[model samples]
Target: MPQLAEKVPPSVAGAVLRAVFALPDPVRRLIAGRAVVRDGQRLALDAQLLLLMTRLEGASLTGATVPEARQGLARGQRYINRLPERPVRTRDLAAADGIPARLYEPKGLAEGSPLLVFFHGGGWVIGDIESHDSVCRYLAVNAEVRVLSVDYRLAPEHRFPAAADDALAAYAWAVENAAALGASPEAVAVGGDSAGGNLAAVVGAFADRRPDFALLFYPATDMSVRRRSRELFADGFYLTDADMVWFSDHYCPDVERRTDPKASPLLADDLSGFPATYLVTAGFDPLRDEGEAFGERLREAGVRVAVRRQEDLIHGFANMWGLGGRFQEALAEAAGALRTGLL
Candidate 1:
């Protein structure tokens, strides 16, 4: 049986969400219950409220089948995320290796403007271009750049190395077709969140022609070992340990290959020549420590890197930017960084 939230129309859901968020901070916080503090980091009040709502909805990714999980994610987005804003131009096209892709060009974008080759995150199992349409549109408009969002094949169907191969190929295609896309070939960047972030970093480390910049949102840098953040925030905070295990088991399956540099970018032998990067990590995310550690590794390898920890948020905040609040603020900051980096 569908829960009340699952059955509510998007309009009603959005209205209820807006009404709830419009309440004063104190009132909202009161409704969200007490603050969630761990490792000296406090979760934001709004994030807490969203987390509580997620629990009440009762649609969890942890135990559901692949189709059910995908449906849940898409349905949840309809309920919580706003409709994507229209870009100046949007076109469906095939990326490298005939991968499905979409191009978003912002209003007033000049010739030779920078371009971003974006990969959508879903632990390489569930997300798609539609799932990340809002994110690509937000980046395209806010950064004043063109965005090529690739719909790479997902896992449990197309497993390890498939997503990575598609990401690299799509990036190559973007660089080769940059002029046609109204962007400069030399100014193309690569970016993604979670699994997609891992792919972007992999491209940074191994692409034949490196990207000009990278934008990572709380990436899963290492799948080989569970870090402190994984244990500390394992159960609650939206992305649970069980969910991670499910994703990994489906995406990689073979435990022995988990440490491959392609799977775990943090284990890559050299990052000295990697492109400049701006990586964001959520304070309460299981992937937080590994993402920050990857930044440290990049720095040690003489690569320019900026690691920003959104200390009051949870995992998947990047996908929640449509809801406004801190999520938008964080993504806006990344857009500014992308603009500056590509200049």
Candidate 2:
């Protein structure tokens, strides 16, 4: 590990710390107070937990059914609707196998504009193009690039390989129809957060030709539930252990499929021939160690890799960019990485 810095800039570090601490005590208490119980024994996720989760994530759940999960995801979409509008031209493009995407093209683009196909994060269960609109908007406006935000199918309703297939299809479409979108086929990149990031990595690994760069934000690289970090930072860190368990159960009900490389990229035996990678990790996130470890593996495989650890930040900080003060700093860092990698 690199030598630790004594202190980081307060504007970034302090703000993140305050945000994590400012979460409702009841929610924190629930996470901290949780205990492992036998499987199939019902645990009440009552109104209090639901309300707390709703407040924190802008998701709502009346019950644990798939329909309720979709409703909760819609609530998150509504919450992200507050960002200021920028000039972006929207289009419905046909991707691989007729999988469609809502592409956002920033105004005032020259020919051969760089393109970024973004996948939204929601543990592959919740979230869509609408849920991640703000993030795509920010990237398109600030980075001055065209962004193709995909609405890939979610899990439990559409499981493992389905999402990966959609991601690959999207990439193929971007490559074939780059000119129609006013982008350079060669300059196109792939990126996302959480489950989306996992998809991005998987697609990069499997694409017949790789993207120019890969951007991963707090990606869940490993699906194994046994990591030490999973146990250590599993609570009071925004993305709780219970929440991950719920997401995993919904994503992969069949335990045997957890080892599938498409489901868990960290378990893949080979890491060669993928695009150069920029991986960002939140220090307090349960997925942090695995993301960092994946970056290391990429470097070991002779792929160019840059890893940034936002030590004071928690999981899902990217989605909180519009609301959190420290988000600009993080975004700036990400933009810098993209510029270096893409240019």
Candidate 3:
């Protein structure tokens, strides 16, 4: 067990919010009903609640210009990470590929400890190291492993394979310079969430010195092929199909390139002998089906794969642990998986 891990507190504020947001259908309908529901599945209560909060805070990005969207997301991310954090030691570095990154080391980690090189999720476009700081800190502390969060180049500004290439390079760098950061080269793992998760899977395919394990959270395994989740949870949820389409267009301008194995690991011809892997998906996430598909393919290819579906969550639950409730518990479970897989 990790020596010093923290969980988001379920205070009075959270209780009030849930009690209000999780109100009866008739009451919700009178408030913001049909606007955020689909097929009467009721959407995840936490997700719908957050959407209502975001809408109130002016967080819609649909049809927003690139600059406007980036700024808006960055602002919200900054606010979320603004709360005081746990006492994990952190530092910044530039990968050999010149991509920026942040490293988080739990106060209790000994020399030559396990390391997870992580990539942040934003559909290959709008996330940064700062945005994912809380998640990294939580993982580093709870998993009892150091986390190196890579700030890969985003879409439109830097297109297809740019983020992929950077993720790979960061993984390589983490392996090469492990001892310098008090980590073990042989214990390094590659992981990410969403676009970052996609990048992690891409890196997982490399025949060259591969990481000991791979961890992906709701990754977009198939960029070119649309799965059932794409149609199923296309709207009202946190990550909409329209946003996916926009992200794909910006990241891979050429439709053909999106099918390339490097861009979509799910389309890879073979995935045999890949390292031990852990994949997580959210039931209500638009990318849920694709994430599970990747894990299933890897298992079928004879690789050791472990998959977990957060059946009551949304697209970005892995990164929202700080929001409290079940999200924090889910993240803690994921960290336990990370430790078990790596150690």
Candidate 4:
């Protein structure tokens, strides 16, 4: 729960949030509309929908199966369409290893500007460049950097290594074509939200020639879904326990794959030599603890790191760049981090 002083009143954003909160868990689960009987545990239609909505809203679907996760993302797209427009430049480009991506770059860039290669959050199953378009625009314009938003492959259909492969490819493309994008090769950064953040962290850990920095927003660092925060915020406040199970089921159809370090970077043995990192977590988010834990691990491994907890915020607040006053503050903090890292 947020402190009284940090609480946001019932503004337009707050109203929408409240409306989402007001819906019965059963009703929200029905909205997701994906259900299956697993291990003799059958979820009611409403139950599935509620779980889906919670995970999608809170960004806890890092390991969702591709089709079901895409359904959730479609629901999110409908919601995003209801919001007002912000400034952005959209383009289709070839990423590393010929992966196609729809890039969102903010307008008015000078020659040789810094660049940020961003991946959208969706537990590596849902989300696309379009899903995170608004966030990329806000960061590019406010931070005065070129933002290359990647449309990486998702899980289940694409599965574990696919998203990670695409993320690394995007990072490589950003470094290779920085000049063409009017970006300083030495000032390229990589980042994403939720599962995308996990990809960012993993890529940073393994990049042969690492990026200048990394930006993670409410990242899902542990795919195992056994974190204490998962149980703590499992019910109300957003992102329930059922949602995590759904995502994990989707991302890791094979029960044995859950333990793979590639699926959960928190299980990785090494974290040294990654770029400078800026990790932002929402206090009310289920993934909060794991993101914080990852930051601590990075620091322990001698990586330059900074962790910021948005105490009053909920998950997916980064996409709320046009919503409330706090959005500006969040943007400022993120932009400041990028400036310090890239410049």
TM values, all candidates: 0.97, 0.80, 0.87, 0.77
Candidates 1 and 3 compared: the better one by lDDT is 1
Cα deviation of 266, candidate 2, in Å: 1.5
Q: Predictions ranked by TM-score, top down?
A: 1, 3, 2, 4
Q: For model 1, how does the per-residue alpha-carbon lDDT over 254-309 read when each residue is reduced to its tens digit?
A: 99999999999999998998999999999999999999999999999998899999
- Runs of candidate 3 with Cα error greater than 4 angstroms are 1-43, 61-63, 82-86
Kindly indicate the candidate among 2 and 4 with the higher TM-score: 2
lDDT of 3 by residue, 107-128 (tens): 7679999999999888888888
Q: Give residue 338's lDDT in candidate 4 (0 to 100).
A: 87
Give one digit per residue, the lDDT tens place, for model 2 in 107-208. 776778888989888888888887788788778777777889888888887887788889988888888888888898889999999889999998877888
TM-score for candidate 3, residues paired by index: 0.87
lDDT of 3: 0.80
Clashes of each: 0, 0, 0, 12
Candidate 1 whole-model C-alpha lDDT, 0 to 1:
0.89
In the range 58-142, model 4's lDDT, one tens digit per residue, is 4333223455456545544434332324466778888887787765556556779898888888766677877776677778877
Which model scores highest in TM-score? 1
The candidate with the higher TM-score, 2 or 3, is 3
Using TM-score as the yardstick, the better of models 1 and 2 is: 1
Off by over 4 Å in 2: 1-63, 80-86
Query: Candidate 3 vs candidate 4: which has greater TM-score?
Result: 3
What is the lDDT of every predicted structure here?
0.89, 0.74, 0.80, 0.71
